[model samples]
Target: MSVDPKTRPPRASAVRKAVQVAPTAVGAFYATSMETFRCMFKRPFHAREFVQQAWFIAGVSIMPALLMAIPFCMMFVYQINILLAEIGAVDLSGAGAGVAIIREIGPVVTVLVVAGAGSTAICADLGSRTIREEIDAMKVLGIDPIQRLVVPRVLASTLIGMFLNGLVSAVGLVGGYIATVYMQGASPGQYVTAISILTKLPDFLVSEVKAAVFGLLAGLVACHLGLNAKGGPKGVGDAVNQTVVFSFLLLFLANSVITTLALH
Candidate 1:
């Protein structure tokens, strides 16, 4: 005998709802993020929240940024020095390092650090607040969570992404200097000289723009996932995992598109 329509499980309906709602959710997230950015330009600036988030994103990301910078710097500089040595172009290794570090590696590594560390923290914090009903309380109190919480995180992450790009580039170049000058016995003067000769304004600006876009992507994903989290305690954990995966996926895609367009 067939079950009554009212008595039947809602599994199929739930699946349909999920499929339909997913796109709407994405669109809503994007719209809300843009609105948040716009709101930040208005009065009643949340200086306390903005400064706190900036500190959290930048301060907590520093160690990981350095860790990533050091290893990649050494590896890439070593490889470039070896190749330059083979061609007796060792003096230009600094220029090669500068180009690679500033144009690609610096922004990519810095954004990864922010996503893996800063985004995780934001997801967890917001997810916890969501599950604990603090977000609902905010709504009850007539508070706009997007204006108060979201804009700061997104703006802070973007600005921090830009800052970290510069920081990582500096560290990477320093490592390149040591590798080329100390490890390979290339002259310090030539290593420093070539960087100025090879890199210019456009490379620096492109890197900064890439980092800012990456940051905005990280913040948007983290905030969206965190706010929409469900299923209680386990859901928060899952949302954090999804945040990392989604952030990295979008970041790489954005990086590829930006690099292609900017370079062309």
Candidate 2:
């Protein structure tokens, strides 16, 4: 028997609602993101505050992540060296691995760390203030919450990400080199030669640019979610979790697109 149109599911209704809500959510998110970006540049650049935030994000928060990543990098290099040696591709080891790590993994991993540590902290702080009406209180006092709160955090994240990318790249290279050359018994000169041949100035530029973009995205996502957070403590926690998850996903997607385009 043919199905009657009257008894059919309201697929059109669900589609229409989704289409309607999509634009509204997109508009709201974009508006908030742009406002935060503008707020980041409006105030006087506070060197001391920037430095403090940088120290926390780039130094303190980076430590645990680096500690975990270094050993993993070392292990990866050792395994690669063994495999390459078996396949007579040992000459491809040095700069090839280094360049790959810097141009791709470095920024990606740095952003992941930032999302987990820095983004979570930012979201929680802002969300708490929002929930407690401190953000509203600022408006009542003629202080722009975006300018005072969002700006500093955004600036801090961007600067910190740039710095952390450099730090992680160097540490990863060193760890990989030591592991491959000494631990894995790959000749030191071979490793150095490989690195020297593989790495280029263009790779460094691309990596730095990726780091900057990742930093901006992470900060924007965290601040946007936090500022828009409603409800109470549960909302704050949800915002923090969402910020990290979204940032991580975006960072990986960006890395893939950038890498594909850059290499192509």
Candidate 3:
């Protein structure tokens, strides 16, 4: 049976809503981003707030970063070692794992943890403040909420992202070393030497850049959604969810683009 025409959405109305949503979302993102940039460069900076938020983001992300770093590094190293052995390149295990981890896995895993943990925390805190009209109160008192809140959160997230990248890289290298030396029976000296020979300092720098970018974008998305959240508690929850999902999407795309440009 066909549905009643009257009960169906009008094409015009649906199109109108769709048209309105894209511009609204884009405008909101643009406004929040510009505000964040402005807040970042202005004087009378929120150093205390930045340090607190950075510490909080880093603290919350540690466990997840470790948990993510170890398993994936081990599994990748184990598999690559087997393949390399078939070609008589087993000694290259550390080089392969080290290069791969720093070039890609390090930043990706660290930012994944940061997005999952830190961004959610920022979103929730801001959402609660928004719902309670604390943000509005700040405005009424002549305090700029964006400067007081979003700027610090974004900086904190970026700094924490960079920190976590280092942590993940260290953990992944350690895990890969164990897997290569013991599980794969590779020579420890050869493994270390290969990594030293193959991976350069620039790889680490690029990875750090990716992590910082991911963190900054995640913070922007979270703060934007949280600041605009409506419908009370439910809206805040939705905004938090959106922050995680959108942050991940933006991050992976950014990773691909950054990797391509950096490598080529």
Candidate 4:
């Protein structure tokens, strides 16, 4: 009644692999994150460099998304206005649409855009370097890869995320305004007043923080996958793809948690 090895349960082997890999991956992620954070503080804080990188990652890369976002924001406001008009509650349309865009949708959408652009770039850059053995070469030169490579990226991304969120929020609001006021013939002063009354400092601050966290998550995930990639060119592509997917998942998860805790 002895079972053949081939027919034996696969659960044990699967569990073993999971047990071995999961902790190692988790440990590596944390270790790299900590190293990146430490390096961020120790390095010379160049405001010019930070601003330049921030402009590229957050500002320049945001144009395409912003262009696309404008019409969507307008459509959303138009729909909300129509619904409110039908309900004889047209006055609430401005506040309702404004709050929805600024507090939640704007930051979330901006980060998604940033993840698609900036995060992908980060992943590809690091993955290429990793495949070329540049990371290893840095180690040979006694330079810490995390310090030299990961820190600036993480910091730049965090700042960029915040900046982009603000930019998107502003742009979306203007789009909403144009749709609600100019297109719908809503009172300009009323629209402005509604937004002013509905939007609070706390909402904006929370959204900004969420964007920053999202940036850090995106950068760190991309760096982790890229640095750990294997199999050369194919590996680089795989890592870039995984980085985008994982970053997007983590960003949404983090957003849910933050919104639940901070906003609620």
Residue pairs in clash, model 2: 94-195, 95-194, 95-195
Which residue pairs in candidate 1 have backbone atoms (N, alpha carbon, C) closer than 3 angstroms, thus clashing?
none
Best by lDDT: 3
For each candidate, what TM-score against the reference? 0.89, 0.87, 0.94, 0.87
Clashes of each: 0, 3, 0, 0
RMSD of each: 4.3, 3.5, 2.4, 3.2
Cα lDDT for residue 254, candidate 3? 96
lDDT of 4 by residue, 22-76 (tens): 8888889888888787778785655565565667686556786688668878998
The local distance difference test score of model 1 is 0.90
**Whole-structure CA lDDT of model 4:** 0.83
Q: Estimate the TM-score for candidate 3.
A: 0.94
Residue pairs in collision within model 4: none
Query: Between 3 and 4, whose lDDT is larger?
Result: 3
List, residue by residue over 1-264, the lDDT tens digit for candidate 2: 987868867997788787998788668778988887676667565567666766767755678568856886787777777788898898778866787678876887788788889888889888999999999999999988777777777778888888778877888888888888778777788887788687898898889888888888888888888998898999998899889888998888988888888998
Candidate 3 residue lDDT tens string, 76-139:
8898898998999887888899898888899999768988999999999999999999999999
Q: Which stretches of candidate 3 lie over 4 Å from their true place?
A: 1-6, 9-20
**What's the distance in Å from true for residue 239, model 4?**
0.8
Winning candidate number (TM-score): 3
TM-score of 1: 0.89
Give the per-residue Cα lDDT of candidate 2 at 197.
83
**What is the lDDT of every predicted structure here?**
0.90, 0.81, 0.91, 0.83
